[model samples]
Target: MPEEMKTLVVTGLRTQFNTAKGPVAAVRDVNLKVARGEIVGLVGESGSGKSVTGLSIMGLIDAPGEITAGAILLNGEDLRKASPKRLRELRGDRIAMIFQDPMMTLNPVLRIDTQMIEAIRVHDHKVGRQEARERCRDALGLVGIPSPEERLEAYPHEFSGGMRQRVAIAIAMLNRPDIIIADEPTTALDVTIQSQILAQMQKLCRDTGTALIWITHDLTVVAGLTDRVYVMYAGDVVEEAPVEDLLDRPIHPYTDGLIRSIPSHNAPGQPLNQIPGITPALDRMPAGCRFHPRCPRRTDACLEEIALRSFGPAREARCIHPLVEG
Candidate 1:
């Protein structure tokens, strides 16, 4: 067996945003890591801070939002303290992000070839347009897009939703980046399309040694695509474990709830189990255990803030009364 190269490591990362009332914590004390050729799933509901964590790592958090604590280390380099110039230099070349909507990455008017070629050239000026365009075509082909040459001359509007997303992914891989933060890139696609994309993504990362952090709310996706899983609730990670171990036995109540809510778990005509309450608002986050209000296993001990504690060598949970049994 060989050791995998660490590509991204996050420690105690806290990102907050300013609202009219006050600062709202979007990501709190998050720690995550991904090594070359590995896919890690960051799973949670919509307001669970998974996407914010991704944005923070990519240095894409806008005004009124900022990283207040912790470190985002890219192969031991701290991203929080990195300069604007340095961050820009790393963005497309070393690290790339595939946004939820392809439109967020693609220009409405520009040809696909124009956009992708420029993405490559901007990072390394030495790569000529012809060379970059060839790479762009190859990238598109790698993602299962057909007629790569003709597609390069097409505009974003010409493609279907799934195809557009495949293009966005192709551009992200243009530089053969060390890491990619994918923000629900397949959520809008049909399941058939989603599966195709997932297979291609897995193959791409394995072949190229790109580490991936897939931020999504879908448990089934995690089951199929990730090696490890992090379950977040109310801006904090409630559980972290190897995918098979976590799936076999979810330690945190929130994680258990999420697993139960997956569509596959429902009876043919029965309603699915829903988590009891909404994720607490950032400003209105509950004291002590953020998930206490909705957790079935919450106890008086949950009234005090619980630090993430390990259950086994590779498994950790934030709940004091963690569910250790299957």
Candidate 2:
């Protein structure tokens, strides 16, 4: 929470999609901060706009989805106003991203060595070919890839699913960037591989002092891997708090419902709690509080627009009838 320790600051991010029906606000009024060497988990369901928020920060959104309003600041520099050339220069060198699919970051036709060495060359052209190749091998080994030297000669298709993911992650960490945005990088892997990758990522972040934004729908993964957590609902951050505080005592109804829905939290033989109803369509968003319809504690007060209110030190929630008693 200290000002000096903060590495990335994002505020008032609004991203909308232009569709035939009209403009759909996929992300709205979202604000979050990641401290140096800290990992923050952005958790929500499939259509909660978590991925859109990450893409917006990375400046990867295309014509249909545009970031309309917001400031994305990386180490005090405003990324929103940066020119295309500036963004390109800063992207892979200072800020790297590990996408959900390895293919997004890897080219099937190119050998691993070519892609990785090119990445290093782009940032440090003075480094010789031999040194760059050595760095590429080191990067591969850092991600737990075995026989990295020989593997470098193989194409992406030759590696297994988990191996491909490891290669992609290695590429992201090659530059030792200040921040890494990982969007469900482990969602498709088996549990053992997931655990290994998560541990490696955590160790890398701690050792290299890299800030990380891990976007995922799995609360279980977030509980173990993140220093802090932010719950997104209907394109807005409904709650934000330290990991322990949010898990132990969530302040918002939406947060409570998500925690309750986790199978591990239910009593043996008891029916699992499920939040009914789907996320509201962005174009047809509700007039008042976006969550009012499904909230068990909803009342007439919920019929008015609500903004996030401070709950305690470093904790905030947006709800007319908060689940937690003050």
Candidate 3:
């Protein structure tokens, strides 16, 4: 991809947290590229560093945790090297993040319109209050909220869970940012609401040409929502491929296990499939392949250090014993 089309490029990212025992590496050697109007899925289990990657990109890692290495480039500007003040300026204007919990984005005491208008004026002081309110109404409508004008006047407590999530999404879209990192924004909603939000998000990206990195552990969610998929395990990305290709012909053992575990893939009465063994603790992680202990295809060669090797077009996997050969 040309550098001009790439809105967000992350390379060799390593984020660690300083603990009483020592530094725990929560993210390692992570590389991602997102182009305008593209939706990329960052998939993994609960502790797969998916959220950390999103936070790292947004420069949200707090004191105990620090980004130790690598570059985060936004339209060719290195964000990792940017000052705190610059980061704050860019956050709601050029880049935005939608957290899992709607409460994270909404203030209970404030009216929806007030909060959204404040968000807009904070970054672009030139926007008049009435103009910002109009933008907020449009955003709410775009997310499929009903009677956006009245909804805007309501407080955060007035809406249901799904409606609150939609309002949160509306706030994220208020600025028309170049990049949006959504950390499982629809995870808490029902399946039907989740589907609706996913469709709206894709449409918003298409209409506005915003690049989105969707962070989620549910493979089913990304199977249809994302264009490309990256699978992470034990702080490392284990596989990268186009969404269809990855779901249809997964190369890494870990990727295959994730697909197999999806409930729809099994018979109704059969015990749901599951990946064996829990992810290893960061400090006590296995020396070689972090997934070897749980991988059914592991061999002696897997005991050696592995690197992400390229396969067929736009595919890569970090494994010595991939389930499929390119």
Candidate 4:
């Protein structure tokens, strides 16, 4: 793919926050790229900085949390240097984010239609209210909402949790943004609902050629949904490859441990293969590789900082002695 065709590219991205203890590295230097019509998954456990990386790309990190270094290029535009006003202009129109909580995007007291039309008008004032309403209704139906016209007339509280999330997703798709960073949007839904939403999202990306970044800790979700997966540990991308490659032949020890730890990998009577030790706290990340303390395959070389290097064609890992040697 040509450079100009890339939808999103993040290089040396680092995010940190100020706390009473000290500056905590929430997201260490990381890099990835997504092309038009591609689906990428940022897979990691909680506090592994999956969401923070998404927020950094969206320019949503606030207050003490800031992007200390790196470049976030959306469609070849450097967002790191974009003005606040320019960022606002790009938001919702060229780039949109679907938050984990639906309420964060929806107003409690406002009617759904009121909010949806307002969202459209914010970027396109020339769109008449009635025209915008039709677009909103179309978007809601696209997400499988029943009687979208009537649903639009009701308040957010009137909808169930699954339905509310669907609405949130519809809002993200309203403008057909170039890229969407979904922060575990389906994590709250039941498996059935999650599958349906995932299918819809996949179809949306295909039909519109819009790139997508699905951030979640659930390997199961990434297994079937994503084309490529990036496994993060201690705020850094420890492994990245095609989804099947990462799952069937994980290069990094942490990635191998995560795949082995999945419930489906265990037999009925067998105990799960959980990775030992908790993820190190941000403020107390171990020297060298952040995951070295918890890594079962640790070696003397692992105690020093390592950079992501090629493990094979189209695959990379941060460990000095990765399981899948070249």
Q: Each candidate's TM vs. the true structure?
A: 0.96, 0.97, 0.97, 0.98
Q: Give per-residue CA lDDT, model 1, range 177-288, as digits (tens).
A: 9999999999988989999999989999999999899999998899999999999988999899999989989899888888888878889779999988787778888889
Tell me model 4's lDDT, rounded to 2 decimals.
Answer: 0.91
TM-score of 2: 0.97
What is the C-alpha lDDT profile of model 4 across 1-326, one tens digit per residue?
77677999899999999898888989988998999889999998888999999999999999799899999999889999999999998999889999888999999989999999988999999999999999999999999999998999999999999999999999999989999999999888898999999999999999999899999999998988999999998799999999998988888989889888888888877999988899888887889988887888888887777988987777989988788886
In candidate 2, what are the lDDT values of residues 173-255, reduced to their tens digit? 98889999999999999999999999999999999999999999999999999999999998989999999999999999899
Error (Å) of candidate 2 at residue 128 is 1.5
lDDT of each: 0.90, 0.91, 0.92, 0.91
Task: Tell me model 3's lDDT, rounded to 2 decimals.
Answer: 0.92
**1 or 2, which is superior by lDDT?**
2
Task: State the lDDT of candidate 3 residue by residue for 1-326, as single tens digits.
Answer: 78666999899999999999999999999999998889999998878899999999999999899999999999999999999999999998899999999999999999998899999999988999999899999999999999999988999999999999899888888889999999999888999999999999999999999989999998888988999999999999999999999999999989998898888998998998899889998889898899999989988888888999998888999988887887
For model 1, what is the C-alpha lDDT against the true structure?
A: 0.90
lDDT, candidate 3, residue 114? 83
Give the top-scoring candidate (lDDT).
3
- Model 3, runs deviating above 4 Å: none
Q: For model 3, name the residue pairs that clash.
A: none
